[model samples]
Target chain A: DVKVTQSSRYLVKRTGEKVFLECVQDMDHENMFWYRQDPGLGLRLIYFSYDVKMKEKGDIPEGYSVSREKKERFSLILESASTNQTSMYLCASSLTGTSGYNEQFFGPGTRLTVL
Target chain B: AQSVAQPEDQVNVAEGNPLTVKCTYSVSGNPYLFWYVQYPNRGLQFLLKYITGDNLVKGSYGFEAEFNKSQTSFHLKKPSALVSDSALYFCAVRDTGTGGFKTIFGAGTRLFVKA
Candidate 1:
């Protein structure tokens, strides 16, 4: 079975603080993604990495950055956390082949609270 | 742009009763549809997907979804509802014709099964 793990399940940070959320997948997938889930907003993509050191912005990538120094690890960084940034962060990974029909495997998610 | 829509915000069902979660999508061309279920405090789990071929695709935990090309819908269904099945459900879509590999998710529906 494929397993995806996040560094933190829940986190609290003050305004203007830098926050880092980590995700790791054991399936050796080539594509990794970061998304913020909010009520009525669904899962909006923040950033995605197709390969090491490669990143692309998604629908809502403001105030967020990503790092993919290695294949197994993907990190989401908040330049300066704000109350509006509080959300459930999700990480997913998928294989590159099959004409992009691959199903993404997700991590447990990190619920971040910014005060 | 690819997008997915989950019309219902919540669905309530009694245990042992059949349950259905509605999902509709719009894309440029042929679509890859997906259904995911999220337990409390857990990540979204892949329930099923429809790429091509069979219109009805079966997935984990007795869940299935039907792909309707004419309607542009992929509705998730289960024969029996369990109290344990109560969770948040999301529908996703990816445009196969578009060269982009990004997938869009719906706002999500909360499912409640009463015993």
Candidate 2:
């Protein structure tokens, strides 16, 4: 079974602090994505990495960044935690080719609360 | 623009009754539709997908979705609604002819299964 795990299930950070959310997938998927979900706003993509050390900005990547130094691990970084940045952060991994395009395996989300 | 839409924000159903969550897509080429479920405090989980061939697609947790090309809709349905099935559902579509592995997701629909 495909398993995606996140470093923390819940996190609280002070304003202006740096925050890091880690995600790892057991399956050897090449695509990893970070998304922030808010009420009524759904899931907004923050960043996605197609390969190690390669990254691309999504719809809302302003105050957030991501890293993919290893195949199985992807990390999302909050440059300066703000109350507006608080949301349910989700990590997902999927295969690269068309055959595995639509289905994404997601980890349990990390709910971030900035104070 | 290629996009997916879930018109209804919420759907309510009584236990043991049938339920349906509506989804629609507007994209170029053939559309690959998918359904995902998110339990409270959890990340989204892949429920089912319609790639090709059959219009009816079955997925985990006794859920299934029907892809209708004429209606540009892929509504998720289950014969019997269970209280445990209450969750946030998302509809997504993979853009086929856009020359990328981009998937557009609906805002999401909350399903309330009443016992």
Candidate 3:
């Protein structure tokens, strides 16, 4: 079975602190994504990488950046954590996007609380 | 611009009763629709998707969704509900733009299954 693992399941950070959330997938998928899930906002895409070293901003990418140094790992960095940024973060990976295939498999999410 | 809309904010159903979660989508061409379920603090799990087929697509954990071309809707349903089935359900659509692959999610619907 394809497995997407996240570095932390729960995290607490202070305001103005830098935060790093890591995601790894064993399926060798070429596409990796980072999203923040909130109550009424759903899962808003923060950043995505189609290939190693390639990244693109999603709808709500402010104050967030992504790093995809390897094929299997994608990291999301919060430059300065704030109380408003506290939410559940999810990481997903999908097989190389094709004309017809784009099924994303997600990892266990990390719930971050900024104090 | 591609977007997803989950009509219901919450749905409550008794165990052994049928349940439905409604979703609608907007896109330029034929749309790729997806359903995911998030439990507690876990990541969203892929439930089902509708690319192109018989409209009625069966997926994991006895869940199925029917795609209506005319109405541009992909509504998820299950014959029976279990307490374990209670979770936050999300509907997503692929944004087929030039930049890269991105999935747009809707404001999730919380499903409460009562025993």
| DockQ per model, Cα | 0.78, 0.70, 0.75
Please, what's the RMSD in Å of model 1? 1.3
Cα error, residue A77 of model 1, in Å, equals 0.7
TM-score of chain A of each: 0.97, 0.96, 0.96
Q: What is the C-alpha lDDT of each candidate?
A: 0.91, 0.90, 0.91
Please tell me which model should have the higher DockQ, number 1 or number 2: 1
The TM-score values for the models, in the order shown, are 0.96, 0.95, 0.95
| Pairs that collide, model 1 | none
- Candidate 3, residues B1-115: lDDT per residue as tens digits? 6778998999999999999999999998878889999888677889988888799999999999999989989999999999999999999888877443788889999999999
Give the alpha carbon lDDT tens digit for every residue of A1-101 in model 3: 88999999999999999999999999889999999988899988899998999999888999999999999999999999999999999999998645545
lDDT score, residue A7, model 1? 95
> For model 1, how does the per-residue alpha-carbon lDDT over B21-91 read when each residue is reduced to its tens digit?
99999888678888999998889999998888999999999999999989989999999999999999999
The lDDT of model 2 is 0.90
Candidate 2: docking tier = medium
Where does candidate 1 stray beyond 4 Å? B95-100
Error of 3 at B42 (Å): 1.5
| Candidate 3 chain A weakest lDDT stretch, 10 residues | A95-104
Which TM-score does chain B of candidate 2 obtain?
A: 0.96
